[model samples]
Target: MNHKLLPLKVFLLLALLSLSQMFCGINIQTENPTADPGFMATGIAATLTARAVSITPTVTTEQATQTATQQPTETESQQPVQTEPVIPEAASISVSLDTNCREGPSGDYQKLGYLLPGQTAALIGRNSTSTWWYIENPKKPGQYCWVWGEYATLHGDISAVPLTTPPPPPIPIAG
Candidate 1:
């Protein structure tokens, strides 16, 4: 064919091949234009090698002796991976309305502070009637007091709350 048109056809073929990334050999440029075609493809010819190789590999078949290969006594073993135990969260309580936190479960006890509508406290203990909840004081940090559960929202494991005995009633004093 025409040598002048060959370069343009090759370039168009390369462009089409490059647009479709599937063809791997499109961009490969031969380094030695003077190298022999047959040996150059094998990479050894790229060196313009003369009298490059004379060695040839030959194979022979033979029966192996029983002692030639030994079987392993033990195999690679994997130990069990240890995981951390998941602990359940403690129960909590929230007041629906502003409620009074008292020293004891009853109304007679001295009022400590008020647990507001939006505040939450830990439901530490519960009375036998379940009417009162012992909680971390919402107003006073690091301290605890009892609040009536009538307007309270109980969350988490409520059964996990331990039973507690409330203090005795306050004695009335004459003024």
Candidate 2:
């Protein structure tokens, strides 16, 4: 191992390790498993096996007795429960020009209906690139369609909009 090449060798090793981990879906657990950080990846292939433990009857009895004896205090019962405020996601867009709404994010999809200029529609979601917005079909109620984002003026935060799968085309009924 040349001293001058040590840094390069270390960098190459790290790069190879990262690439291998990414391809193999192997994640190294750096923190305690008990503290769930919400963002941690699930369905991990690795497993942690714990040694067997024996508990006496007296300890179990005492624990149960303690739990049974505990009761909610008057103050605790009177206090109002705190809840997170639900912030409604903005999912509405105004059509800048009269554009045909399609079943999917692309023009190749079947045209569901037309969104008139200056008309507003509830945005359901967007494609991967956010180039198109999937909105509720104004002409046909209960149905949803996609419109090009370039032709529409979004009123709210487009990032808040969810990604949704486009509905399947309606099968034609043969007369």
Return the lDDT, model 1, position 164. Answer: 91
- Candidate 1 segments exceeding 4 Å error: 1-69
What is the C-alpha local distance difference test score of candidate 1? 0.72
Model 2 residue 164 distance off true place after TM-score fit, in angstroms = 2.0
lDDT values, one for every candidate: 0.72, 0.66
Mind giving the per-residue lDDT tens digits that candidate 1 earns over 1-175? 9875575466556645774663443453434434444443544443333233223333544964332222233323445555466455568876656899999998989999989865778898999999999988878888889999998877667988999988888998889
Per-model C-alpha RMSD: 26.4, 20.8
Error of 1 at 97 (Å): 0.5
What is the Å distance of residue 152 in model 2 from its true position?
1.0
lDDT of 2 by residue, 96-165 (tens): 4589988887777889998976477888888778888888899999988899887666764577888777
lDDT of 1 at 49: 38
